[model samples]
Target: MKTKLLLLSAISALMFVSSCSSDDDTITPSIPELEALELSNCSSGIAEGETLILENRNNGVDYIINCTYPVNGDLIIDPGVTIQFGTDATIRVYNSGSIQALGTAQNKVVFTGEDKVPGSWKGLYIISSDVKNKIEYATIEYAGAVGDDGAILLWSDTHLKMNNTNITNSQTYGLHANTNNNELILENNTITACKAPMYLDASYVSAISNGSYTGNNTDAIIVDRGFIDEDHTWTKLNVPYHFPNGVDVVAGGNLTVMPGVIMKFGQDSRLFINEGASGPKPSIIAVGTAAEPIVFTSIDNVMSAWRGIYFDSPNALNEIGFATIENASNPDQEGAIETWYGTVLNVHDVTFKDIQNCAIHQYKFPADPDTLTRSNLTYINVANAFCQN
Candidate 1:
C-alpha cells in the first residue's frame, strides 16, 4: 500500500510541474502606452515637501505632475515608470528638491506636452537648488520660457547624471546649465530642434560621448564664461542644425579650450567672443591639425564670407598651430581707437577674416596706466587678418 501511495504522489507532482511550465511559456509581456497615468495613494498628487513614488509601468498612461505645492524633498522615480506629460505641464524640480528619474536603456520615461511647437510647454526647472539630480533614458521636448529659461533650465549648484535623454523642440535651449560650480555627467544624448542645443555656463563640468545636434536655430554648443574640465572629450557629435556654429565660446576669462574638435558654422553665422559682464580678459587656444582641419562652414549654402571666428575678448590669446578657420564676415578687429578699459587681443597662424572693428583696442582709463599698457593687439594673418594696439 505504501509503494502505491508514493507512486501516485510522484505522478501528481510531474503533472503540476508540466502545468506550471505551460503557463510560463504562454504568458506575454504587456505593451507600453503614452497616456496620463493616475497613481495610487502612495503614488498620487504630491503635497509640499512630500515624497510620492511613481509605481506604474504602463506607458499608455502618462503621469501627470500637477503638484500645486512646491517640492522640498527627494521624489524617487523607480525604474519602469513612464510619466507622460499632462497637457502643457512639466515636472518642475523646484526649490532644493530632486527628481531621481532612473530608467533603463530599453525603456525610457518620456515627458512631453500635447503641442509640439516652440512655446508649447515647460520642462524640468532646477531653480535655486542644492541637490543632486539623476535623469537617465528620458525624452523631454516642447519646452522653453521667455526670461532666462529653457527645456531643462538648471540654475544654482546641482549635480546631474543625464544619459540617453532626447531633448527636442525647445525654444531657447535644449539643455541650459547655468551656475558657478554645477557638475554634470551627460552621455549618449540626442538634442534636436532647439534654439541652442546645449548651453553650458559653469565651472568643473563634463559632457562626454554624445551623438548629434540637429535642426537648431542658433548655436549647437554655446560654452559661455566657465571652466570645462580637461578630461572631458566629444566624439561623433554632429551639428546638422542651422545654428551659428558648432560650438561658440563666448567671451569669458581664464578658459582652457582643448583639441579633437569638428565644427561647422551655418550660413552667415560666426563664432563670436563678445564682451563679458565683467572686464576680465578672454582667451581661446584653438589648435587643429593638418590631416583633420577643424572645419567651420555653413549647412545652408556656401557664402562669400561668414564669421568663421571672431574674438572680441579683452584677454591675451595663446593660439597654437593646427587650426583652420574659414568663411568669416570680418577679419580680426583692427585697433582703430580706444574706448573701454581692460581690452586686449592677440592672434597667430589661425587663418580667415573680414574684421569689422579694431583687432585690439583699449578703453583709456582716466587714472590707471596699466589699462593703457594691457590694452593692445597683435595679429598674424597667413590667409586671414590680424590686429594689435
Candidate 2:
C-alpha cells in the first residue's frame, strides 16, 4: 500500500511540472521601450553636409531653423519623432536640398509649435527644386505664423509625394504651393481646421487620391492664380470645389465641368472665362444630365453671395446645359449668367433659382434671338428670366 501511494505522488508531481511548462510557453513577451535621442545644442538651420535624424526627443527645448544659409544636405527623420518649433521658426530647404521623413503606419513624425497654438510657428518651406523631397505618415499642426508661407509651402519647381499625412489647425492655408511647376502627389491626407486646406493653382496638381478637406474656416481649396493650359475635366469624384478667391480661365485654357459637380463660390467670387489672344479661345463646357446636374452656388447659401459666372468674350464652343445656378446675381448688378460684349451663350435645359436679379443677362442681344440657343430654360423665383442691356 505504501509503494502504491508513493507511485501516485510521483505521477502527480510530473503532471504539475508539465502544466507549469505549458503556461510559460503561452506567456506574452514585454515590448521594449523606444530609445530616446538627445537634441541639446541643435542650431537653427541644417547646413550643407549635415544630416538630421530626429529620434524621440521629449525634451522641452524647441528647435529653431533660422535658415541663414540654404540647406544643401539631407534632413532624414525617422518614425515616432516629434519636433517642436520656436517662435517664427521656419525650416527652409533651398539649393537642391531634400527631406526624407518616411514614417511607418504605426509610427508617425510630428511637427508643432512651442505654444501649441495656430500661427505660433512658421511652417516648412521647400524652396528647392529637388524631387527627392518627401513626407509620409506625418502630422504637421499649429503652424501658419505671420509672414510665413502656409503650413507646408512649396515655392520651387519640385514635386512633393505626400501620403497618409495630416495637416491641421493652421491659421492660414494648410498647404500652399506657390510655384507654377510645383507638382503634388497627394494620397490619404486629411487637412482640416485651417483657413484654407489647399491654396494651389489647379494646373499644378499632378494627382490626388483619397484626400480629405474638412472643417476649414474659409475655402477648402483656393486656386491662387493659374490658367488651365490643358484640356482639363473636373469630375464628380472631386466635387464641391470651394473657391474663395475665384478662378480664371485664361487664354489658351479649356475647362470642362462634368456632371454632378458642385462649385461653391465665395463672396464676390466669379469664374471668369477669358478669350484667347491667338490660340483656340478659352471656353467652358459645363454640361450635366437630368438626374445628375451641375450646381453652381454660393458658399454661404445667401443671396448674391458671389458675382456669378462671367463669360468675357467666350467662343461659340462655350455651353451651359443641364446646370443649376443658384444664390447668384446681385440685386444692383447683372444676373447669374452674364455675357459680355455680345458674347453669344448657349444655354439649354438649365435651371435658375433664387436669383436676386435676372436669370440670364447680356450686354447686348444677338442679332437673332436664335443665335443664342436658349431652350428648356427653367426659371424659379427669379426677378427676370432674361435681361438685355
Candidate 3:
C-alpha cells in the first residue's frame, strides 16, 4: 500500500509538470497599442497583400502618408478620419488596388496638407486601377501641387465615382482628367475656388449632374480638345454653357447646336473650325427657330468680350439659322462671323447686335455670289454690315 500511494503521487506530479510545460510552450503574443506608437515611427508605404485600416481615435494626431507610394492593396479609412500629407506626398492607386472611403455627411474623410494651406500637398492620384475606387461624402481641399493635372488627378483607365463631395480651394484645377480612358462620374458635388473647376476632354466625362461650378477664376469647363467626331446636339437643358478658352471643331467633326442653347464666352475666346484633310469636311450646323433662337453672348455682358467664330474650311458645310450673336466682333480681331480660304457661310433669319466690327467679313470671296447666302438678315447697333478682305 505504501508503494502504491507513492507511485500514485509520482504520477500526479509528472502530469502536473507536463501540463505546466505545455502551457508555457503555447504563449499569446502581445499586441502593441496604437496610441503607444509615436507618429514619427509610423509606416510610410503600404505593401502588397496588406490592408491599412484607420480607426477613429479621439486623439488629435493626424495620420500622415510620408512619401508617394503605389497602393497595391486596400486602404479602408473609417469616418471622421483626417489624413494630413507631407510635402508633395501623393496617394497613388495602381495595379488593381482600391480605396473604399465612404464617409457620412457629418463625418467626412478629409485630405488636406500639414500646413493647411493651398497647394501644400499633392492630391490623390488614381492611375490604371481596374478596381472600383470610390470617394463619397468627403472633403478634398488645399491640393494641386502635383502638376497641371489639378488637385484630383485621374489618369490611365481609372474608374472613379465621386458623390456628394466638396472639392474646393485648389491651386490650378479642382479635378483634372489627364487620360482619355478615365471614367469619372460626378454627382451632387460642389467644385469651386480654383483656377478652373474641371479640366477635361468632353469625350471622357461620363456624367455631370447636380453640380455647381462657381467662384472659379476661369471658365467652368476648360475643354482641352474640342473635337466632336459624331453628330452632337446641345439642347436647352444643357444651357448656359460657359466656354472660357473657346472650342475648336477639329477636322472630320460635326457639331449641331439646337434651339434654346445659350453659349457664354469669356474674354478673347473664339470658336475655330479646322479644315478637313481626307475624310468628310467638318461642319457646324447651328439651327435655331424664331421663337427659341440659339443665343451666343459674353459671360460678363461686356461688348467684344470674346472674338467671334472663324471657319477655315472652304469645303465644309456651315449654317446659322435664327441665331442671335451679342457682345462679339472686337475691332482688333475679325468680325462676328469670318470665313477664310474662300469658305462660304449661309446666314438666314440671323441677328447680329452690339457688334464692334463688321457683322460679316468674307476673306477671298468665292466665285459665285450665292456662295455667301443671306436671307432676312438683321443687323442692329452695328458698326459695319459687310466687309470684304
- Each prediction's whole-model lDDT (CA): 0.55, 0.76, 0.74
Give me the runs in candidate 1 sitting further than 4 Å from their true place.
1-50, 66-69, 115-119, 128-131, 145-149, 179-181, 202-209, 223-236, 240-254, 260-283, 295-317, 326-332, 335-349, 353-389
| Candidate 2 vs 3: which has more TM-score | 2
The runs of at least 3 residues in candidate 3 whose Cα sits more than 4 Å from the true structure, single-residue gaps closed, are 1-62, 73-81, 104-107, 129-131, 146-149, 156-158, 178-181, 202-207, 230-245, 256-269, 285-306, 312-323, 330-334, 339-350, 362-378, 386-389
Q: What would the per-residue lDDT of candidate 1 be over residues 340-387, giving only the tens digit for each residue?
A: 455453333443322344333344455655422321223333232323
Report how far residue 225 has shifted in candidate 1, in Å. 6.2
Q: Report the C-alpha displacement of residue 240, candidate 3, in angstroms.
A: 6.3
**Candidate 3 — what's its lDDT?**
0.74
Record all residue pairs in model 2 with backbone atoms less than 3 Å apart, i.e. clashing. 44-65
Q: Model 2 over residues 191-229: C-alpha lDDT tens digits?
A: 988887787777754355667887888645666656676
Which is the winner by lDDT between candidate 2 and candidate 3? 2
> How far in Å is the alpha carbon of 150 misplaced in model 2?
2.3
Instruction: Give the candidates in order of TM-score, highest first.
Output: 2, 3, 1
lDDT of 3 by residue, 231-297 (tens): 5555553325666777777667778877877777778887777666666667788989989999888
